[model samples]
Target: MKIKKLIQALPAFVMLTSTGVLANNGYVNFPYPTVISATPSANTQTLSSTEYWEVVRGDELKTGVAISFTGNKSVVLLSPQYSHDMNGQKRAPAVAENAIELHTLQGKASLSATYNRDEMSGYGFAPGSAAVQANKLAGQNATLRLNQKISDDDLYLLHVKESDSPYQLNVESNVMVQEEAALVLHADVTGAKNIKPKLAIQVSAPDGQSIPYHFTNDKLAFDAPLEHVGAREGMYNVVVHSHSMVNGLEVKRSVRLPFVHQRESASVITYSLSEQTAKHVTANVSLNVSQEGRYGVVATLMGYRDGKQIALATSEAAQDFSTSETLPIRFTLPKGATGPYQVNILELKDQTRLQRFVQNELVTQ
Candidate 1:
């Protein structure tokens, strides 16, 4: 009877021990059915500073196997146990506790600008991994150099367990680029999720001239012309897009530049003209110069309509006029010629051709 009692108690002790290990831990499901058969060689696998892991979801079993860090420090059971007596006394064992110590895990550091899920780098820390007793199941890690200074104490890395089964992972980093304020025409050149290797960066101003810029690594810089910088400043959107080869995933970042004010004025010296063909109309046409400040000396002339082209002998401007000075165009008929006609004038203002004509005030037969 003593021997039989001892034998009966053995199963109970094993059950209790197994049940205790199952409590207060996390779980990771692998992709294919993977048995956690071997313990990682402790202190032997010093993973790369940027090493990470990848696995399918729901693949970890609950019983008959377990996995842990090299020193048995952190262990997780993938399977569960079951027992049933002939009298229908069935007792299913509790799920094993996850061995990964949540407190030991660090948050992910900053990520490279090119970081993406399809391209998983080594895992180091995960964002919010600073919590205690959480599993380090996020399949990623990064190794720190022997000599590196970390400034921000609250910073953390980003991580996801195999249970989440993220297609890609991004590890945040500490480095950031500084933005310099300047008046420029900025453009974003990045591919889309459905596109690759073909990105366009272009910016156009109101004057129809392109603003120059430069891009290297992941930083964008403006190299606009010095003269046009004042005119190129304004509201513009810049973007960089990314597309995934697998599953056709797409991502993009768009930046809206604050309104930059630039000083500019019209350069194309232009004017309007009108013509009538039935009566002798004496119309006073005026030409308004657009530019300010004197641009050297220039001659002004008024052109009178005679069929298709204006006869140069019709009229001309006074030599004493200054730049941007508007002059009235006067024309008188040589008595009886017809009942209706048209009038126009051309002024030579600082080597530019300025012309104006009557928009109305035409008497017809």
Candidate 2:
């Protein structure tokens, strides 16, 4: 039962990692893995870390993690990012005590960084001679074990680098899962184009059934598309694999990412704008919630004056809704907000089971 629960939460972790690691860079998706036309790639698995803390969210509690690496030379960069709080603040000094122990068949402790309540400079913990000594990895599988000194409640990022590789065989999407009609994807092997990257993609439904794909044969890039299939109200994952060779060596890279499939049972029946008082404009979203749970509505109330784009106010609130009818959200208009306004709904979330966020698109009168 414990293992099952952990597996279920993996999708959220992948989504979070993608948002941070995958740089959109206007159009390009890589420095090492240059993607021509794509959406995102978290990181190449040629060198990977076992951030057991990821399975448990922010806390680094209970049992260390063992990481596995590929490639002839590799080094592990361990550091904790700035910690945040509910009130939107960054914790200072970035104190931590993470221990790294490297092991190969040859010897142990090739490189180690022990942070003991160490005050970090917000960039990273000072790694000493680890990258220089990565030659210890000479064509052998290396394992780096990290034991958290205190993982009760802290967020961290683990950086593992294959220092000598020219290109990383990777896959990516041109969109964030679904874009109106289909999910577009690409196999990026630009750094090592000698491989003539052959790309394959597979999508799985929330129920673990394989969703099919169609070859795009796009003229601009090496890409494909997968239809959005199934509606089981859980998580859907896309598995992409690329096979190629560089410098007479076979190189293969695979990346898997998860996106949520939400049910459209909750919606805005109607919304109206009314000036109820001397201080606020009440923009009421008549919502129809199919499931009983906590719900939130966020919207922007806009009004124009002097024949130009004018004053704006934001409305935000949450309520425990139990199959109710209309819910009213009020926004305090800033000074100089005038007549003939529009209530643009920003987001409506079911903030409960599955937390279905629905964007209500209705033009106000």
Candidate 3:
């Protein structure tokens, strides 16, 4: 009989020890490792400052505890489950389920907790993780989600809404450019009547030069001179400022665009006067021919006697060339033309003039 009683008591002793039940009604549970410092809200018991302090369940938190983290990491706390009381003869186990206040002074951190089978079924957290904002945890348990900063190349979206405003603004191609390009700014004020809109474009060149253009209409078009842009081959900023007034309310929006100036060598045609006479004048025209294709050349001659305009003649020609080539162009002056005259040469393609040159004097005989 004595041996059987001792065997029955052995099982109860193991259960009490495994559940962290002390003889003096104290219970122990696993503690977090990276908890650098913790201050309890109530001073019921003294906390140890040793490196290996363990926290147990059913501990009465006189006040809420404040925990601090040092690095970019997180911590998870799991509370143990207990069996229900049997026959009103056994007392139910006490468990601590209060919220812990976390303080992240230097780096980022997150906190999570585990739930049992019944609790997990009703909980709506995602499989692995869920992000919850600070304000979203009102009247509920506190769980932290990591906060991160955005990178430089990331795109951000902005939404603007105001009362009684019916205008919208949109911008395209805020950066990057090519040579001989134009910048366009557009505004949409479709159903807005009695509203005044103004657009302004300001350019700051690389060499400390500022150019400003303003328009009262909805569109502001800008085209920078190629020569001026080439001289300052660096970063350029184009700022667009928009203003509107509807029913005594004003709305303003601004955006800055940055781009670099890059240009290639331009194709050119050279003209030289070879021979001249009273009836006609002959000239040699040469092209470097960077690109091989058909080109059109238009030549005009104006005859002047004693510094007075007299006669005007025009001639045009088109030819296909593979490489650099020279051609002789002859312009027939007016009948009985005898005076010094001027010549103008134009390089054209499909009636669009690419370049123009003027030659001063050739005596027509």
Candidate 4:
């Protein structure tokens, strides 16, 4: 399929926002950045065949990874996959080294790390320092692997300070995410090549209830059913983190989203509007409500104007329900919006929020 068509065909769950996908449901599909390639100059060697991008705290990372080639090649700039959750757990793993290496350089060179800061205003890589000391890789054809590795939570922008020939680099990264739900939790992590990533997740409720769910490292991802009892009104949070060793480099990923706790008590069974009521610019949306709570209907009123079908307006009305009464919804009839209008129900749900139903529409008399 064509590229544009492919992107259009993606599910609504995918998005490129600060929290990966700006989703409110238990579903998520974060769109990885468009695989764009840079136009290389005649002197630029084939170190990167394609400019790869992935999400790190809503930022796109251009990665060439561990590809090796002859010639000076293009200087490979890297982005990160770092994770730091709430409760201030933002620190590097004891095993991580925030440093770079000049592995197998054929000519003279000076190499150092330049990494990115999360949510910075200017938005670019700054000079990075080893946790214990400042270090740089130098010398000709020498494999000077810095003893300090890059922090997993830090995005990288490594620079080949001065290099005359081809060189190899291996980098590490980290990312973070948080979410909330009461129904189901589903997640998928995809990156690297020929290596299976592992997931570890935790769910917590406002009342100090904690539940742990793990992704089965099978060919298919896993799903965990969530249920919070005592705290039904307060927010519930879920945190997920996944890790993998790609090309001998450690990669960590995380993201954040929201979902709501729902209850079922009402639904729009049918609706009605007479020529007389239509004259008053109103429609009676009939719903089968059980308990007393906010009940509503979301529909577009379709009318005709100038011999063409035109939407008068879309309306959403919610009110306290008692005795299963028909709720009257008001609409602003545009001038010359001649009816028989159609009440097209886009979503119909009972007091049980989110359990929506797709049904037919009603035509005004």
Candidate 5:
């Protein structure tokens, strides 16, 4: 039910603007339903009643003619009479004229172009060539102007194109995401190998505002504002860190962030240990395994003497354990021992489980 209300409210919700106009400094993010205005209601669908545009004297260039529409309604530029392309062109500049046109529903539409007159000003046009000024002059509120005399072709083109300017947001692609582990501060810790790692991402907005995002399993995403970290069109730093335990001893691993714009994903790795076995006397030796995903654990002890089988004991534990906890395990040595003995520890690699154990060597006195 809430979703329905949100969906229904989307249109008006999008039209809401932060400030009257966008910030002048380069990029400014505006929410949905970017409002566009033109003289004729035909130009701006949002306008009520009839809006008319006239080239009283000099060429009158329209403002906010660029058309963009989000999801539902599309922006339509309706020119009663004009037949040209984006540039100042006409099927008959001497007769029929052309104007700028667009079809997007949302986003800012800039309207401005260099003027031309009869191949004399090195501006004017032929039969079907057109060009609109792409940007606005700083501090000059976008408004119509009649600076010079315009032919019927130029006049008609202005009305036709300016009426319904349709523009589009062409999002090419996002560069690969990258993550890095926190700075390491240990002396004996080493990195793990041959395993996929997990990475945490932090996102911030241009104003330092922070937000949260979710990614699929084994994946992490941060869609918050860039300001979270002093946002702007500059280098933003992302980091990832991982921790686990082996044989009651903790282990850690990490990696640096993405260096290339095309790369963005990374993870930290852990170790694995197999089943353990001891000989002669009972002794607790530490074993370590690396890996954090789903895994299984198994432990066993066997005794052997002079190429002959002897008495033995076994122990096992299975479930889910992360690298963060120390697995305290205890075992007893072989009985009726009179000669040298050996203990063996074996780990089954085919099972779908992460396991690690510590190995210790001891003798009977």
Candidate 6:
């Protein structure tokens, strides 16, 4: 983006009057200035001059003073400068800085700036443009402005307006869970009554599969059910699409909603290990099966040194558990010698069922 630059000779009688003043001796400068467009009814106010400068398309600006523009199509170009300190008998020229501060009381603006140092440094909104301290302005109206400190070689562009989008949509819930055999989603929208609104919902699973649903009504409020039996124990993306006719043309907007399905196993199991001795370690395991079933228990003893597994031992058994019944099982690691070892007890039903109990312990012998 090209920025409009304002450059002019400094009049000797010009004085600074704006609140944006550097601590030392500094002033703003305009170089290669150009006015793109402005309305005849627009006006500008400067600190040094009480008279407002009339808005024009090609008017040249004289100093780097703080100015406020009002009315339609009001625009100008400007930059800032600071005086250089003198050393011994030699006097150095003032250094030019690209730090600019802007505040909009009741308008919108778009700003773009190029930074010689870091590209991200030139794009912030603040109240003042000076390098030193500055004051902040307050107002209820929304304002679009840019505050940045740039080198004299960098360029920037700023455009301001006073308008808002004609339509807006807001969702009350971004995340929902499938509960009690059904998943329900809801949303609220505004500024869409006259446009004949339409709603569409799409669900995307983890395996790159998508299911789409379109609503029949144009109501701003929505409550819909998403039925999918295959969605289980993972995250799914629920996208809501809103379409409407604006000025006899169709406009569409979409938002991604978060949906999750979490189903836990029917049983719970816990285990603890006895203190290790020179010859073996013993683990005490407990299981509370909520559902009656035959469950398999596996205990694995593994030795680790320097964070890598060195040796392994396995023991397995099966038992029938009644509903709400507690079962206690014990396993012994028989490897005679060890430095650090881990014991893991896992209980499950066949290979297809989720693990009902998973417990581990670290011990030293």
What's the TM for model 1? 0.18
For every model shown, what is its TM-score relative to the native structure? 0.18, 0.49, 0.29, 0.45, 0.17, 0.27
Give the residue spans of candidate 5 off by over 4 A.
Answer: 1-287, 293-300, 304-311, 318-320, 324-329, 332-335, 338-341, 348-365
Rank by TM-score, highest first. 2, 4, 3, 6, 1, 5
lDDT of each: 0.27, 0.49, 0.39, 0.40, 0.29, 0.36
Residue-level lDDT of model 3, residues 30-59, one tens digit each, is 111121111122211111110001122222
Task: Using lDDT, give the best candidate's number.
Answer: 2
Clashes of each: 60, 2, 6, 24, 66, 10
From the highest lDDT down, the ranking of the candidates is 2, 4, 3, 6, 5, 1
Clashes of 6: 10
lDDT of 1 by residue, 1-365 (tens): 64598898777545533432121212111111121212222211111111112221212211111211111111111122223355554323222222222212354233222223343323332321221112333332322211122221212222222222233222121111112434323222222223333234444443545657776553446574423222123333232222233332222222222222222211223332333323322233333434442211111212334433232223322322233433323233332344223332222323222211211222121
- Candidate 2 has an lDDT of 0.49
> Worst ten-residue run, lDDT, model 4?
43-52
Q: Model 6 off-target regions past 4 Å?
A: 1-166, 172-176, 194-196, 212-234, 247-249, 266-365
Best by TM-score: 2
Q: On residues 136-177, what C-alpha lDDT tens digit does candidate 5 reach at each position?
A: 222121233222234433443232121111211111111223
Candidate 6 colliding pairs: 5-32, 5-33, 6-30, 6-31, 6-33, 7-30, 7-31, 27-81, 28-80, 101-129
Query: Is candidate 3 or 6 superior in TM-score?
Result: 3
Model 1 bad stretches (over 4 Å): 1-147, 153-229, 232-264, 267-365
Query: Where does model 2 exceed 4 Å of error?
Result: 1-72, 75-164, 174-183, 194-196, 199-236, 305-307, 356-362
